[model samples]
Target chain A: MKKVFVLVLISIFFLSVLSSLMGGVVNIPLKVVLEVFTGKVTGIERTIVIDVRVPRIILATLVGIALSLTGAILQSLFLNPLAEPYITGVSSGAAFGATLAFFFYLPAFPYLPLFSFLGSFLTLIMVYLMAKRNGKVNSYVLLLAGVALSAFFGALVSVLMVKSGRDLHALVFWLLGSFSGRGWSEVKLAIPLIPLLFIPMRYFRELNLFLQGEERAFELGVETEKVKKLLFFLSSLLTAIAVSVSGIIGFVGLIVPHISRLLFGPDHRRVLLASLLLGPSLMLSSDLLARVVFSPSEMPVGVVTSFFGAPFFIYLLIRRKN
Target chain B: MIKVHDVWFSYEEASVFEGLSIEIEKGEFLGVVGPNGSGKSTLLKLVSGSLKPQRGSVLLEGHEVSFLSRKEVAQRIAVVPQEYHLEFDFTVEEVVEMGRYVRGGKGEHILEELNLMPLARRSFLTLSGGEKQRVVLAQALAQEPSILLLDEPASHLDISYQLELFDLLSRLNRDGLTLICVLHDLNLALSYCKRLILLSEGSIFAAGRAEEVLTPENLGHVYGVSAELHSHFGKPFLTFFSPFEKVNEGLQIHIICGGGSGSLLIHELYHRGCRVSLGAVNTLDSDEVIGRKLSLPMAVEAPFSPISDETHKRNLELIDRAKIVILAPLPVGPGNFKNLLALEKAVYLGKEVWVVNPDFKGRDFTGRVGEIISRIKEKARFFSSEEEVLKELENWAS
Candidate 1:
């Protein structure tokens, strides 16, 4: 039964990829999209399919995978159900970093992603230091520190937004998060970091043991302190990269892992695999709606996700209570 | 196989262990027992290598435990914690398989051995406390460790489950697995563990065979309660007196009881600090067993034999020394007819005589013995229950 469910998820992911490639402002058909893939088509259709839409799709998919996988690892690491990439303060710090980039009138290409990665990485280190007590990281303290630093960075971003005159519109758009105008460069930046996901995946058994608690995991042969340090660094790196490429996309990291757990159980291997497939499916489908719903003008994909993800998460919580 | 050498450990301001040392032999079932805060659990943690001592060392097979990696330690030692709560739904098999993290193997044989195969697919969070404990045990056992450490594994279980779990542990110990268990329940410690380490105020108060280590003096000193160790089914069982009871020191009370009738009244009066002695009871009688366990001054006779002149003289001497004598609602038997005669002697001697729950409607086994009871009842004050008798005794004391 689980195999069948996984197969269905894979099929839906492929369908979402194909539909996302085809459904846009020009409304390219499936046959033309296939022809473009096979090099039978050229000109505007080819540019739209390969150069325009494909990179955005890949970038969105990579961001989705990074966020959801990081969320899965964090939830198990902290042994908390509500843990996600956003809770770690990385997204807000990245947004603050990007806001600074726009405020300084820096070029968008390498500077924005670099500045955001630096901001998120520095914020992660700050939270890590704040949460450390007597040479050990307390997860509860880590979560609280994350919340406090996130609000601090978020306030700084707001301050920058109020100060910048010409960059205000760009700052707000970036803060709201979107996949527009992103191309192969962002895709190239994120794909190399994909292998980092395997670090947490390698300790899938230890991740399962962590759900019992840190002391229990240690007793069960997991080098808990070492594993915790490695996972925290890896997840923070993944979140920082994802936020750098796509500006603070909400709920994909928080909700996709939960959705996967609701479908496949809490075993990290299955949950991780499910998140790998479902993250892209959700992101692609949401991005598709973001582009096609309003036609030439588009709603930020973050708004679409939060607008739907929040209610769906609440529904899941209510059902679980029963 | 395991030795803790003069270890010092503290959690913040409170020191849990101060230069405490003990050794556990291979194939021995050793119980670590003490009151709360006595550092029994801390000792287990130190032995399991989860908590490092500030001074000295914990050695497993002559190698320092802290020097070994977690996988190396876990490959030889498995711990069943006091309690485990899983928020996420993981099946029993999956939880058990987590034990194989250090040493890779399927836990199918362990699940079958624990009789958890039927519920192997069930979510661990949904099981009962006993079932969860069993699953946790199976998970620990799946490590295939030579030594198993359990911290109050039966604390949450009901009576039957507690027995069942201990029985299983005993069977495992018999199979050549060295077991070190931390337990607060002294009776359970006595019954299951062959050797015991009794901790008191961060030090070893006593350590040896369970019967020798779990003495009344040691228990009273450490726990501040009066404890009596009795043999139940040829195993030592401990019964404790609550320290909160009012003290009535120097008040002498003699109880004439046989069968199992006087056990509770003796415990109650003794707990109230009365100097209690027993009237003649036959050997192997339930009341005699309790009297012997409590070390109360008592007269005894052969089982099912009539009370002899010598034993009756002893019973009368006990009655003479008492300010008050209580006749428990024991059945009137031919062998103990002389006890009624002693009660008459107490009444004649102007000692305060009380008959508790004097319902002789169906208790009379000898037809002639009821007449003597009736005669004694007229001279004795009759109370329906032990509570009323104790209340009246308190009034007399004041």
Candidate 2:
């Protein structure tokens, strides 16, 4: 209950902050923007606030939530303190997919989502197959294999981009990650897996048993491979959805769960729950700041997140050591 | 109940056990002791269902163990391995709680009985080896298993904990838990075990009550040591005596025994292995136990025993195989005078004769050693060291 309150409280806070910043008298005057927000104002003001900023903020929040949950699950899966959602070849594979899409001279490059989705899925399978020796899967082997394949796929992605001749700027932007193209369409695409992802998130105690080792868990009557497969399928689907909409957002999925763990402990129950709630709140607020900072010269939401998240991640690491 | 029938196990090229069969009844505290690579640990693994036997099967409580799912097996039997390298820093409470993993629930009583309640919240990895061992035992007990398989569980424990652990196990057994333990300590086995099984070269060499099975002869043959089996308050124990040594002024054994094979038999007669002076050969000869191992001063001839010390003293020491006489046809002759006198001394002492080998075709003696052999022949019945040797020589036939 207290956790929910904290999440709700942060959500309302970011919502108000975003609304006030986008139109409040500093930009379009408080009364006008307030009126627009309340359906009292007429014409362009209503269109701008409701259609533009609201959808983007919601998208940012949902993406953030996805990234954080994925990060938390990945960490415990490998029993590695350094593992993150992106570490499993998701981002790089998605980028490779997007780069391939850009090369085809296809009418709608937005179809890049399909390419990145496939790339991510392929990388995930490669990692699983490489790590599963006989019937056993070792964490170090999985991590190393994921890292190597992700790098190799990333190089292939870069080569594809270089061969294509249609203004590299657009392809580069998509590869780096940004929330500009996301609206209700992308938002709708990402939310369906929220329920699927929540299934594993609810079973953190089982995940804890798994961390003890499969042999022990199996002795305890846990169907360990099933649990791992479920986690893989759910986390990958959610990651693919997030990457599909937003080019290849790094650091959010990598760092959010770490912060979640620092606050909520290693128990996936609390960490995943907190992640689901806090992610959107943090990502939404960052998008709001990205929009209003140095007005008229829009900054990519990805740049804003890195500037904020990277320093905070380092601080958490050092502070955790202390 | 544990039944291993015709089970075969090996590590790579070396076969530890093949077609071996044994049955252990419920609540039986069975002690399994063996030489290295003799299938002691392998037997435990097979019974625990931790390893699959290449041939035949293991039945527990009249059910096939290998076919049971891991959970079902874990619920039935608890296995405590020798090494405990727990990576997670779980508290004692948490560690013990894992034992109930098979129950898919919890058992608070098992942890408390192991005296782990006080250390419940203490980190498991931080504890000393003894403490960790207790915690591990607590975890296994937490399973509340009907049968327990412990493999060298006391290897890391100090003497105090070793005894304490065994006491706890005995108490558990008294409460009707069946235990099968593989132990290297013979005395500990004799003291605590209701039955003892001695394994040699991956086969059951001896098994019965400690008093019945752990005889001096059995120890000498199975463990290759001429040991003295001791008993205290009706509980049998084993302590070795070194071979006869002139240094002690006891029966000086001019062992006609050859080969490094007999070293352990001679060693058990001494301290550690045994305490006995050696004789009847050059210092370099392998059969001279103390002469080769302990640098004991022996009446050894240069190179081979000369007619005086070599053949003669050898014949004299042959008298030591028996205070009576042991006619080992080491071809006695004129040069082996002292050996002949030694045999005469055995006859005079009225000691019995033990013929170690009956296969050698030597109606012979040349040196003093050979002379001693011929003299002892009438008194000792020549027999090989097989089951038949004791049967043929139980009463001094000569």
Best by TM-score: 1
* Clashes within 3 Å, all models in order: 0, 44
What digit string (tens of lDDT, one per residue) describes model 1 on residues B1-398?
A: 99899999999979898898888899999999989999988888999888999999999999999899999999999999997868899999999999999888768999999999999999998999889999999999999999999999989999999999999999999999999999988889988899999999999999999999989999999999888888878878988877845556778999999998898899888778788999789988999988888889998998889899999999999999999999998888778988888988999999999998877878877777666667776678989998898788677553
B41-134 per-residue lDDT for model 2 (tens digits): 8888788776688898899888898777767888888877666545545678777777776775556787668777788878787899999988
Q: Estimate candidate 2's alpha-carbon lDDT, on a 0 to 1 scale.
A: 0.66
Off by over 4 Å in 1: A101-148, A164-166, A316-322, B158-160, B257-261, B277-322, B330-342, B345-351, B361-379, B394-398
Of candidate 1 chain B, the 10-residue stretch with the lowest lDDT total is B241-250
Q: What is every candidate's alpha-carbon RMSD to the true fold?
A: 3.6, 12.6
Q: Provide the overall lDDT of each model, using Cα atoms, as 2-decimal numbers.
A: 0.86, 0.66
Candidate 2 colliding pairs, count: 44
Clashing pairs in 1: none
Q: How high is the lDDT of residue B40 in model 2?
A: 89
Q: What's the true lDDT of residue A130 in model 1?
A: 75
